[model samples]
Target: MDKKTIATALAMIPILGVNAGADSIETVSNPAPIQRASVKKTVTADVLNVRSGPGTTYSSIGKLYMGNVVEVISESGGWAKINYSGKTGYVSTDYLKSNESSSGGETSKPSGNQKSIQQVTSSILRVRSGAGITYSKVDTLHKGDNVTVESTENGWAKISYSGKSGYVSAVYLKFVEYVDEDSSGGSESSVIRGATVQRSSKSYSLDEMVEVQYIKAQNGGNLISRNNARTGEEVFTTYIIRNAEPRAYGKPTKDELRYYLDPANFEGYSSGLMQFVRLDRYTNTITADSLNKYFASKGTDCVFNGKGQAFIDAAKKYNIDVLYFVSHAMWETGNGKSALAKGQVVTSVDGVTLDKPVTVYNFFGIGAVDGNALEAGKLTAYKNGWTTIEKGIDGAAKWISDGYIHNSKYNQNTVYAMRWNYEYSWHQYATDVNWANGIATMMSSLMEKYGTGEGLLIDIPDYK
Candidate 1:
């Protein structure tokens, strides 16, 4: 595979990937009511503040603009306790006018586009497998999530998300005017809203192969067995270097290699690699506090606090090497400082050149410029629960685990084999001859700081 074929294109676009699963909430809110009983009420105010309680002192959780519709649960002292999204909140009774036409009764039948788009009013709403709360949650949509309504049944709205249909309570649904932001076959947002349909099977290209392996690893299908410890460690080492080489240069020249291998820097890189070796055995044990502190030390402005939890979850869920995964993300994202890491870039699979760009929160730079980047981005969109940090971390971990560690096809499980198996393997992950050494240097650096261990005692022969 021509690695640069896709990477070069991605380089042309702005890099903007931010971690969106961090702790941004001031308080954790509860899910909305499940019982299907309520009276219709419309918000008459231009903007009505939804509070946590039925008083002036209650914290405002969200806002509903004029013409917004909601289900009134009960009446209070000039306040209406309403069901918005999946959460219960209070609004001023004066601003809520009772709809006698549909009060405690079925809504009038929908006509045309009025039934097509529904505005999500809840702060956080779950898209379920079935209509009721008993049905498992397939995904969650935020306050402003776009829903292309397909149909409704018994106060449950069936809407499309990333090409998949799921149910949301109709009580929190509001009919909004249709806005044609992009008439050119919908926007990247539209595609991401329902992007999970299985692609047709074909001869897998390099990117496609990465995608397959990533998904498989995520599903816990492709995992390194304990019996394969020796081979797994070797493959893991190779991946570290493959990732490290991209940091110095696409293909480092002799001087560039020397600059990277200077005794001072080499030791740091080696420490980085050794940390991976130690943490691979630790599995998914990273704590949220530890991760948050690390990010804070690095000055990374993470959007969500659950990111650390997300990494730990992915590591535990997929059996991926935690230290190596975290370090690789730090390297790629500049400790989450890069534009792509910060979630600033927005474009379609074609990147910034497209007519309509899709917001991508890919931390590991997956599918950035490649056609697969868009698909990867959509799969990791917030709606799918693979927010930027989770997407980047999990996607990269799965790719490394499936592509190198315990690779069934190439059998180049060792770093030495991956670097020198030119005659046997069709493609080498990194072309630089000192790729392994470079990663070993990074491993040394990481270990020197955050961990304690003997560095990788590897010998390197310099080429002049």
Candidate 2:
């Protein structure tokens, strides 16, 4: 048969095994009062089938992958009724494991040293799949919402919300006394402080920042190579420089740049507001173990691995925030997988010749400029005697500290200031509009994972 005719016949063939009339299988209904205690579970199987009913006889409607978190509203026999993709579905309880306890029963109330209950104080708080902001958000909790505090770890409070066990920032949760059914008692107040915001003297409208970016784009800015002059004036373009030749940059629209530049766009999210945090401040809370964990989380396997102490030492020496310093290095070096980070042997660059070949490492892309990033970056590393990974890290930290964080003229200590330098528009760190945002996100992720949100000073620019 011809290809088209054969394809048509194949399409007409009915799917084999699955019963066509299986739609009549029992739909999910409200669970009985006794079975209504919601429990959070993680899928243990590589792939578990979600069905219309509780057994293999029922047809498969969807699938759940391993490590996927789901809320088990109820259980019967060996099947779990879970809220899957906005609809109810059933999966074998054998393939699921509870996040809190192995028993398929009501979540146990806190006892002993564990606090009984806590109230959400933030206008809106996100319940993450894991303890850190790097994890996906599972749900949200609103102000005044009371939740049973199962545990607290790494500045996150483990709680069951909307049938799902997830973590919310402990900073926004206040302790509330739990009263038994027979007893009546008043609740005590113990509110943990969240991020503190301070207004800066410098101010600029969103339009002014966008205009400054456009001006920089046209005048040989740090990373910007060309502009879409014919298309429109507001739109700017740059190149994404990998190890190879520079590739065409994405044309970010003026609106997109505005969104990235506007401080108000980040005010709603506690972590997002971290972009305005002063990077010059040093904290003793950061440890080598925490930095190692952060590096491992990013899947960094290069020479930068196990160099956490070097990063901490550099941060302390430069009086820079360890989180910012490490995150900036991770971003610049592609989580320590970039060519410059891995080290490159060089004897010469830009018509300049050296006496001997030296293997140089650049953990922070220090001298990486547009057009010739790789060569220039390696040369800069060699000149600075960054022959070792630790030396490279310390050297980069010193450079950044002197040039931007502690610079007398620029004083661009925060990510916001680095991007939108109100004092000197041309002295901004990067030409890429997303540079500050990306670094800030990394900083926030690290902070969320390891920081306790105590004594955080956020300097938000007050735009006129």
Which one is best on TM-score? 2
What is the lDDT for 75 in model 2? 90
Per-candidate TM equals: 0.34, 0.51
Question: Residue 206 CA error for candidate 2 (Å)?
Answer: 4.2
> lDDT, candidate 1, residue 102?
47
lDDT of 1 by residue, 24-61 (tens): 43223333434445777666676788999976689998
1-464, model 2: which lDDT tens digit per residue? 99999999988765445346585544244334338667777666756888999789899987665545577888986788887655678999998876674485554333423344555555557889887888899765544455666665444667763234788766566555433432211121112134444444334676887777666665646243243331321111121234335445555566666777788788766446767766765765468988787777657465677888999899989877787787778767767777888889997866777788889998777778879888888889988999989999999999998888877667777887887775588788776666676676767767767754454456667666
Model 1 scores a C-alpha lDDT of 0.50
- How well does candidate 1 match the true structure in TM-score terms? 0.34
In candidate 2, stretches whose alpha carbon ends up further than 4 angstroms from where it belongs are: 1-194, 203-206, 218-254, 348-356
Residue 1 lDDT (model 2): 92
Compared with the true structure, all predictions reach lDDT values of 0.50, 0.67
Residue pairs of candidate 2 with colliding backbone atoms: none
